[model samples]
Target: MITPKASPAVFAVGSLTVDVKGTIGGTYLDLTSYTATASSVSFNPLGGYDFSFRENDGLSSKRTLSISLRNLLIPSPPDYSESVVTERGIFVYEYDMKSSSTIAVTQPNPNLYRYAFNDFKLSGKARHTDDTREITCNGFFLLQELTWPL
Candidate 1:
């Protein structure tokens, strides 16, 4: 019998809520803020994927904050295929402090202090069918996690 190699670990799925506040840099940056909820179990694999390189807690975007998610780990080893797939769901918006109305995931033009979504919501039963699918559980599920940059 062959067992599908599992990830090193799995983060239990749950509801999450977060609120972010910050101040801009040299020019008095205060144009960024975020409120989020932890991804819960959904029919889709990306129920609660939320990770970003923006300011988690700071007076400026000069510094960034992030965390790693287990789902980001590819179950297939390097020996096999090297396919890059979406592991989770992430929602990010950018605002030009002065122009609070303009919200976007990224700046119209790239800048030194810009950021983007490196991850998305991964929900239950995700990637459960890469090449195999036979769970003892009544139902299988996938969970996308948020990972931070080093």
Candidate 2:
């Protein structure tokens, strides 16, 4: 007898925030929306049935992370300052609606997702739309160890 594969579960976002570094080190909790595109293998058709794909050493690919937040919460310049961009980096965290208030090692909460965009830098300026500011960040790879949160 063959066992059936486990079905995927969908959960609502409880909270979303971006951790900014540098002198303006703080967390932006007013996130309206976010999109994270993890690195994917690119293929080029060589000929009949042959194809060439980029090297996938797991960390040698391009990843993108974009977030939209309330314009009222952004600074005057709109885009992140140069210092912050050169500092550590920005991080995006998301928690499930049903996530526990407190998480412990023994009782790990699998609902928490973190996207640490490596060598992250501002790829796009803040585009004002209505009352929100959309910012896009580019990096090498989004760390996804243990669990596939993307």
The model with the greatest TM-score is 1
| Model 1 agreement with the true structure over 61-145: per-residue lDDT tens digits | 2222222232333211101111222445332222211211211122233221122222222111113332211111011123433
RMSD value for candidate 2: 17.8
RMSD of 1: 21.0
- Please report, in order, the local distance difference test score of every candidate based on alpha carbons: 0.24, 0.24
Minimal lDDT window, size 10, model 1: 74-83
Question: Which regions of candidate 2 are displaced past 4 Å?
Answer: 16-150
Per-residue lDDT tens digits for candidate 2, residues 1-150, read: 976555333222222222332211233333332333322322114311111111222232312222321221221111221111215553322111111112111212444333223323332222221122233222222111132233
